[model samples]
Target: MAQSFGTFDIAVLDGGQYDPRWPLIHMTPEEAVRAADDMGVKSMILTHVGKFCISAHSWDEPFNRVVEASQGKDFRLLTPKIGKPIRLDGAEQSFSRWWEDIN
Candidate 1:
């Protein structure tokens, strides 16, 4: 789908459960990152993190790891705070609205 669309950027919401049998509701963080990189996607943002990953108070760890893994590569990983705007110059893309409540 990315090839057909030729999209430069992609966002994965609730993507922390890559394994279908993991008893989680989303894709694994690593799998999501790898898939994005393999697809030649230039940027990826992870969302919909589950309570299990957050109650531990280290939800950002996995996010940071994905970002580090994509460093110096064509892919740029980001975890934007709700309501912040993200702009991509060459792509002419602007992501201004986040969650509705925050916006």
Candidate 2:
């Protein structure tokens, strides 16, 4: 399916917290990054978080892991503030690590 779509500037993927029991249904942060890479994505944002006890990881672990997984990669990992408007067409694409500000 990715080949049909070509490369994407942004890809929204599953960043649901990790659980050994249901690995096939939910994606770990590292896996999500890999999925983005698989699709030739230039940037990625993790979703499907914060609303369930679907996994063992903390509510914020997905974000942290996604950042770690993005290391040395060419693509950017975006975690914008909820309800904040992101200007994707801008000359520079940047997002705040807002998750860092919370406990």
Candidate 3:
């Protein structure tokens, strides 16, 4: 359906798991934003979030940081519900702040 919806963008980096950038594990939020920008990505989707206590910085901290860093950046941040299908019709996508509803 590239002809139908049009090609949106390339690259979806994992922008979570922690900071420091050592041990070469996962890309932090800030780092991910930078990388995406450098790669000239137009849109990004951050998923697999809202896990229970994976890191010490709360369940939603990393995701929060990603949102903060994405502002004024080159690409758009798309936070869809985990396991949900997101239609890429070249139209703007909106998602509810599910984390805010958490206890």
Candidate 4:
């Protein structure tokens, strides 16, 4: 979906990879960031996370990894709460690192 955008304002990507085998199916957090950076996306959102157990890592791993991987990178990662609204009017937005506090 995102790859075909050429250049876009935002990208909503799934931050999951069941395992190494499925990374090609769905991107890992790092891969998503790379893709967004390569595509020149200014803002990116990670969805389909903390809701599944396809991989061996912790549920918050994707969120944490994405944040780590995005440092000094070209895009902003938006981790919006479920069922919440995020204003996309080109205004810079900040979201709580909701996954980090988990035990």
Candidate 5:
């Protein structure tokens, strides 16, 4: 899949899970940063992370780690909390906040 994309400026990997088969597969937080750097991807966002496995605080560790690792690199890795708005371009907007109101 990474090869097919051929180094996109912003590659948003929706799911956190990683497959080892693909060399470019970001199986770990560190790997994600490396891949984005190598591919010249400007931004990488990890999605599909929720409270299902560990607490929100616990998840932040790995997320922050990736961000720190990307420091000084051209790419930016981010893991935003629920409710934050990400402005892509024009009027298009995306929210990171989970739908807690939904029941």
Candidate 6:
């Protein structure tokens, strides 16, 4: 749906809260990547995370899995801080593994 726009090349996906019982409601890392592909998204930013234990995976799992799933893909997976700016030109490459310290 997002690919309808000529400039809508980036997709900010909902990467939080995944459960096998409700696959239709939540999107996993792989699923999100597939969606980006479906929408012809050139870059992807994962949001709606860092809180709420709504699934089996840990809080940090989403970012990690997204990174893993993005292997060999043409699109970029961006994970930035709350206030940090994400470059629309896809030149700024910064990814903070913020959840590594948390247990």
Q: Which stretches of candidate 4 lie over 4 Å from their true place?
A: 1-6
Give, for candidate 5, the lowest lDDT window spanning 10 residues. Answer: 94-103
> Which residue runs does candidate 1 get wrong by more than 4 Å?
1-7, 17-24, 50-57, 91-103
lDDT on C-alpha atoms for all candidate structures: 0.57, 0.79, 0.70, 0.79, 0.55, 0.78
**Model 5: lDDT to the true structure:** 0.55
Per-residue CA lDDT of candidate 3, range 9-37, in tens? 85577766664645376777777777777
Q: On residues 1-103, what C-alpha lDDT tens digit does candidate 6 reach at each position?
A: 6546543578988867888898888788888887887777788987657766778887888888988888887777777765778888757677777667567
TM-score for candidate 6: 0.79
Better of 1 and 2 by lDDT: 2
Candidates ranked by TM-score? 2, 4, 6, 3, 1, 5
Give the winner by lDDT: 3 or 6.
Answer: 6
Using all chains and alpha carbons, the TM-scores for the candidates as numbered come to 0.57, 0.84, 0.77, 0.83, 0.56, 0.79
- In candidate 5, stretches whose alpha carbon ends up further than 4 angstroms from where it belongs are 1-7, 14-26, 48-50, 54-57, 90-103
Clashing pairs in 5: 82-97, 83-97
Global Cα lDDT for candidate 1? 0.57
Question: Candidate 5 residues 1-103, lDDT tens each?
Answer: 4566666657665334444554354356666667676777856776645434333234344555655676788765545565565554535444332333333
Ranking by lDDT: 4, 2, 6, 3, 1, 5
Q: Considering every candidate listed, which one attains the maximal TM-score? A: 2
TM-score of 1: 0.57
- Determine which window of 10 residues in candidate 2 has minimal summed lDDT: 84-93
lDDT string, candidate 2, 1-103, tens digits: 4789988988889877668888788888888988888888877888987545566678777877888898887777778777766566746767777877876
Any residue pairs clashing in model 1, and if so which?
Answer: 16-27, 17-26, 17-27, 17-28, 18-27, 18-28
Clashes of 5: 2
In candidate 6 the C-alpha lDDT for residue 65 amounts to 90
